[model samples]
Target: MTWTAPEPTRVGEPLTGPERPMLQGWLDWHRRTLLTKCAGLTADQLKLAAVEPSNLTLLGLVRHMTDVERVWFRWRAAGDHTVGSPYNSADNPDGDFDDVATADAEADLARFEAACADADRAAATLDLDHEFATARGRRSLRWVYLHMIEEYARHNGHADLLRERIDGVTGA
Candidate 1:
């Protein structure tokens, strides 16, 4: 049987909550929005570019976000600089977004999910005010949460357009 991206059960962001839960809720919502955009798409369709001269694809977005989750939450926020992107390297920095033509969409999606779960674990014991050093200087877990939500929200917008281009499906 042909593999297709599975639909994610997106939860509504909490209307009211503490700072951490509110941020986490929105981040999770955006993450699910990305997966929702890819639902029911076959590998080939997931690999389809948004348009010529642009390499964006649903599968590529999955891979890219997997790296983003790992980098910001697991690596930076959690202070595991040893963790590196699975789909990127100095020689091919854009691998996550550029290598989707033959990528396993199913596995990529699974990896994305795993990365998110790992990120959550990394942040679980930390305080929202927890701070870490980076080349850009110190950053707080709160900053990471805000940045991640913004990142996912921007990418999810691209995902919306890509999905629509692929199958004329639109909206959250």
Candidate 2:
């Protein structure tokens, strides 16, 4: 039997809430939205870069978002320098997107889920205004939250197109 990516239950972002919860809710919604786009796809289907010459695939989006979660939440926001890139390196910076042909789809999705959980924990105790220094200057937890949402939204768009091309399924 071929293995397919499991569907995720995505919650609707709260209509009205406090600042932190609102931001977190929207971020989580976007995260789940990405996974939803990959639901019910076999590993081979996910590995297909339906758009030629782009090298963009559903699995690659998952891998890229996994790294994004780790970098923004754990490394940057939580100030945990020990948390290194899980799927990329200076020698192969684009490994997450470029190296998915032979990748294990199930394991990669699991890793993305784990990264999201870790990211939540890392920022759990952080105040939205908490600031951290970066190579580009400084950023706050609020900024990270917003940036992550934007990141997921952009990638989820790609995921939507990829998934639709893989199969006729559509609707977010």
- Local error of candidate 2 at residue 134 (angstroms): 1.0
For model 1, the run of ten residues with the poorest summed lDDT: 50-59
lDDT accuracy of residue 85 in candidate 1? 91
The deviation in Å at residue 47 for candidate 1 is 0.5
**In candidate 2, what are the lDDT values of residues 1-172, reduced to their tens digit?**
9998898998998789799999999999999998899889899999999988799999999999999999999998898989987679999999999999889999999999999999999999799999999999999999999999899888888888888788988888
Give the clash count for model 2: 0
Q: Write the per-residue lDDT of candidate 1 for residues 34-117, one digit (tens) a residue.
A: 999999989999999975678888888899999999999988888888888989999999999999887888889999999999
- Residue 2 lDDT in candidate 2: 95
Every model's TM-score: 0.97, 0.98
Extract clashing residue pairs from model 2: none
Candidate 1 error regions (>4 Å): none
